[model samples]
Target: MGVLLTSCSAPSPTPAPRPKVAVTTQIKQLLPATVSNKTAWSEDIYQAFTHQKLETSVSNLCSVIAIAGQESNFNADAPVAGLPHIAWQEIDRRAAALHIPAFVVRTALSVTSPTGKSYAERLDHVRSERELSDIYDDLINTVPLGQQLLGRFNPIHTGGPMQVSIAFAEQHAENYPYKKGNSIRKEVLSQRGGVYFGALHLLGYPANYTVPLYRFADYNAGWYASRNAAFQAAVAYLSGVPLVLDGDLINYQDDKPSQTELAIRSIGFTLQLSQQNIHQQLMLGQSIAFEQSPLWKQVFAAADKKRGQRWPHERLPGITLQSPKISRNLTTAWFAQRVNQRYQNCLLQSRRE
Candidate 1:
């Protein structure tokens, strides 16, 4: 009789979550030393990472820090240059668009806001986005025609450290770890809420980007805008149908076919997909599944064959950013490059420290 020895090995235990203090310390170091309230920024960002179960890699952490630096320089109540004038301009524009007389609008704004000053007075003194958002809230709730004038939505679409979109914050508020404080809009003005939501917006979704630059572009544009822009480029090259590589697959607002959709329909017949089928697949453009779609595979394969080279998987979306906050001409490429420069600088800082 021969005795046989058998060895049983247990699966390795899952790696423990990184210590909170260690994670927060790394984030604090990456932040610019000149940034006031460094520890607060670190702690808030740490909460965002943990709550979302987002990876705390140096790159991911730096992406959040860099956007904060660019948008607010770490100030939770960041002062927008000439915000008062901008607010007044928007008020007038809204008033005109809503067919409300200027005097009527002024009379409504004359009512005292929650802040001891008239809404008009507060608008004149508005410096930070937080103040502006508050004024809007007071105006909408208290003043007559406030909601109608503002189209039942706050005029200040973005706010806080990273200037995340309020709509985005509101829509994604279900996973928010902290108390939302009256509304998600109010929370978006806080450091913790802002970073959490901004990080969610920036890195929350999965993108098949080869580098962080495309992700940065997606931050400025919409998600998959970079990838879709590449698709648009390939379609244009193959079909000779001039197209704007703005990364929009189909116009969501219109029932009629968008230029991208029309172009796809023109070639989709050859790719053995009908317009209806094409649309069903293009809707997946918002998800990772878009990459596996018949449109994606056939279009890229055709384009790659026609050009004798593989088309880009992703590219910077050609979108010129138009916002009240912007004074100079800026494009999505500029935004991506600027943030990526900060990303590289932060990487250097991490190495040096």
Candidate 2:
């Protein structure tokens, strides 16, 4: 008490690297639902992490959960109004195109399936792609004429709950640990395991981009559209050609050709890529091969040299949403950006916890 004692302060603890932990665990726990959905989400994250060699952390899973939750609310069996009408329209159109009689289609469906249930009953009530797909499978296997008449009736969809791309599933089927002959609907509904794994495929796939919008565009359009659109934009700006930076690599909507192909043709002479080559390349957009092409490399080099720095190879456009519900020039870039903003907020909450 006579002498003043010097206060000794404890050293401050260094914070751990956030990316190492937050990026994996937080993300995994972010995708929430009933017990089943939680299980599915977990399995999917584990499989994706294992297969992609991604860091098994919550941050990465959270980013994916943010997207999936926004897209489908984790419902693999989600329903859409007027889908049955659309499916019937598609069935009629395909049948007409193939010159199959409606009565024949009906008769084939009327035949009893292996389950002893008539396909017509199922077909009449089917209001979603998954249901429609089951009917199609029955027709192909049980009905003799189904093989020839409606073999291509499999309306492989790439959107909606889980934002699952059928093409993506087929491409990465090897990574799926489940047994064969499992229906897409069943695989998609596996709350504790398979569905979540599917969600990972839809949301966890990697992309080298500065923002989440690019990944969203890839989710909607194709994997490299973000980068490809940038290259196309660069080409347009440099070549003085008009182009839309909407991140669409191929237009699968219209019966007409893709707008991207049209743009390519417009500048084909200057780019020295033949129309046939362009078409072939467009076909490869669904796969990873397109990214490895000379065309892609050339564009990157050209874009880099022009910018005098390594600009983002791709970017999400500033545009409006133009879904079936909303018409007018819409952009996935806008949707992704908004969702990403929400994701960031969620990330902050996780960090605080």
Using TM-score, give the best candidate's number: 1
Q: How far in Å is the alpha carbon of 114 misplaced in model 2?
A: 4.0
For each candidate in turn, the TM-score is: 0.93, 0.69
Q: Root-mean-square deviation of each candidate, in angstroms?
A: 7.1, 10.4
Candidate 1 on 249-314: residue-level lDDT in tens? 988997888898888888887789998989999888888799888889999999889989998888
Q: In model 2, which range of ten residues has the least summed lDDT?
A: 1-10
Instruction: Return the lDDT, model 1, position 155.
Output: 81
Candidate 1 local distance difference test against the native: 0.85
Error of 2 at 50 (Å): 3.3
Query: Lowest summed-lDDT stretch of 10 residues in model 1?
Result: 1-10
Positional deviation of 38 in candidate 2, in angstroms?
Answer: 2.9
Candidate 2 local lDDT, residue 299: 58
